[model samples]
Target: MNGIDIHNYVDCNDMFRAAANFFAACCRCAVAEKGVFNVAISGGSTPDGLFEELVKMKDSLPLEAIQWFWVDERCVKPDAPESNYGRAAKKLLNRLQLQLDNVHRIEAEKPEAAEKYEKIIRTLLPLNKKGLPVFDLVLLGMGPDGHTASLFPEKFNDLPGDKIVLKVPEPEHILPAVPRITLSMQAINSALEKVFLVTGNNKMELLKVIKNGQGNHYPAAGIFQAAWFVCCKPGSQD
Candidate 1:
């Protein structure tokens, strides 16, 4: 939460269009500079609009050179109605002409789900001098409770020290699931850039509170190091 950048839209439709353009431009720039674009995505109602917008611009963007990964995922079957990957698959991935191998999914069904996803990330991402993977861009969404990824305020005890992926139990009334695999704070901050897609009137007051440095109870406030924070909401004046 490095002071959120608010880009107000007249409605959800307008917000989605702007978000799609931002993502497309970012992907194009990354591909031009690095030959490929690696992006970690978040799941939420807000992001669903963005994903739908992205689907319409498949030809205009660098879909072929983009490698996709999830920032976090619910512990459920791939085709489960509640599965984020499943939603993304039907909304975007399944409609694209991109290679199936380019889409890396978190194996939530694996015995050691978090560890398996971490291995997958390590195999695909470039390592730094400290042997940590550095991502190009990470897309995040803020929950109504201000939790981002799987780092709920009440679930701090479940935070991982491995500097990779971890399984966090959902706090009651927060997420509607058991354990979820998510990237650690260290991993998310390691990305060269980050983008937050937050929308709706319900989020307006909380966004203001977070910017004023009053709400530290939420884990999303820990993202002070993120390079960029983008907001999409109606009449939202930063």
Candidate 2:
């Protein structure tokens, strides 16, 4: 928490640029330190924008040294329109043309995909002092209900302490219905750093409540220890 930072952007484009720059810098640092950058990508409209920026950065960034993972995945086909991996592949991976060995996606359509992905992550990345994988960075999106990744408020406490990944139970009536696999709070909290990209006026009031410290009940509060880059307070623009 002491190292966490928060930023606000005037628009999504600005947020995307800031995210891309930070990610590139992190990747470079990871490469210099350990020869690889292990990052988890979040699925959502906001990250699509960030991925767009990443695509444009292919030539300048340390693309080959980066290893990618999903923060969470819907139990759908990898190419499904709603799939986070699908969106990212189209927006960034395809265009960046990074190595196949560097990209690890959750086979969410499989019955044991959650466990399988956990094992894959374990084999590829080093564990921190907590025995949890320390992702260099994990990009997170906050839903209107304040859910981050697939971790909803109602089901947060039920997550097993030792499990790195788990099948998410259905959300409490507000979110879209879909089976999801998510990294546990321990895994998420273990990241070396995290970024929360929040946008638009719809979330302004909720953001105010969160900033005022009245949102302890929200799932996003679980990672309030991470960096947050919100946007365009009410009506102002870049």
Q: How many residue pairs clash in each candidate?
A: 1, 0
lDDT (tens digit, per residue) of candidate 1 on 32-143: 9988888999876668888888888887887778999999988889998768788888877898866988999998867688887888899989977767778888888888
Error (Å) of candidate 2 at residue 86 is 1.0
Shift in Å, residue 55, candidate 2:
1.1
lDDT of each: 0.78, 0.83
lDDT of 2: 0.83
Instruction: Write down the TM-score for model 1.
Output: 0.90
What is the number of residue pairs that collide in model 1? 1
Clashing pairs in 2: none
lDDT of 2 by residue, 120-238 (tens): 98999899877799899999988887788898877877777788998987677644578899998789889888898888778767767776777878777767478887776656532
Off by over 4 Å in 1: 1-3, 225-238
Model 2 Cα RMSD, 1 decimal: 2.2
TM-scores for all candidates: the values are 0.90, 0.93
Give the candidate number with the greatest lDDT.
2
